[model samples]
Target: MQLVLVRHGKAEDPAARPSDLERELTTTGRSTVKAMAKGLRLCVSGKVAIWTSPLPRARQTADILANAFRVKKIREHDAIAAGDLEVLASDWRDLDPQPKALILVGHQPHLGSWAERLTGAVLPIKTAAALAVDLDEDSALSGMLRWYAHPKVLAGLADR
Candidate 1:
């Protein structure tokens, strides 16, 4: 099985949005997510499962990809961290794994931090970027990073 962790697209600054939960994705963020979503569709084959943080920015990002694939609507998961890696992986392992690809849409530090914890390397996954980790067949719990690409890169790829 594969796990895909995605940081939500860029959002209005904390001060600008009326409420943190109601903040929407910026124009740039929507474009970037569209490109990234296209890249994911080209790269992975299977029914995709998507999860998102409770925050509005994440929900907006998920909306950008709503037409790309059949996926679960955004669900709020507290384990998706703001800066804690432990929470990301801890929540990941604890969650039930289906046979298909699982995508967790969430925030920073937690995304990169969790990748570091799992792969022992700091992967700077940007807004709307995704990282795929390969789980071991023996344990089926832990994993190692296979590859990760940033939203910018995916957008570039989509432009080509």
Candidate 2:
């Protein structure tokens, strides 16, 4: 299975919101989304499916990427959802997709932890950044890391 992990765009400072869940993406965050979308549109040339955190920023970023890809397929996953990392890894480890590719849009700490838990490697999942892993059919949750795309790199695609 091919897994793509996307960290949600930068959001408003949590202190300004009543709850972290309510904090929306910043203007720069939206730009980041655009960049991520632009980047994906260039690389990974294939049909794509999207999964996202319920958070506005993540959902919004998914929206941007979905639009860019002309892909309407989107779902919500608790793995990236403020839940347990080990559990998410176990569940996702068993999916056969309806889309040509899989993209997961979510938040940090959980995203970072799940990535490490699944890949057995520590890599920073920066805001709006995405990492892609290639899993052998028999690969375990802690499979080998393939390659990843940073939002900054994707955003750079716009200028090229």
> What do the candidate models score in CA lDDT, each in turn?
0.72, 0.77
lDDT of 2 by residue, 1-160 (tens): 5677888888999998999888888999998788778877776667677888888878888888888888867777766777565555566655664344678888877777767777877898888888877655674465667777788888788779
TM-score of 2: 0.86
Off by over 4 Å in 2: 85-98
What is the per-residue lDDT of model 1 for residues 1-160, given as tens digits with 9 covering 90 to 100? 6778888888887778667767778888887888888877766668676666777888777666656766646556666635554555455556665536767788877777767766676887778888887766554446788889877776676667
**Residue 132 in model 1: shift from native, Å?**
0.7
Q: After superposition, how far is residue 3 of candidate 1 from its true place, in Å?
A: 0.7
Q: Estimate candidate 2's alpha-carbon lDDT, on a 0 to 1 scale.
A: 0.77
Q: What are the clashing pairs of model 1? A: none
Q: Candidate 1: what lDDT?
A: 0.72
Off by over 4 Å in 1: 18-22, 81-97, 138-141
Report the Cα lDDT for residue 75, model 2.
Answer: 79
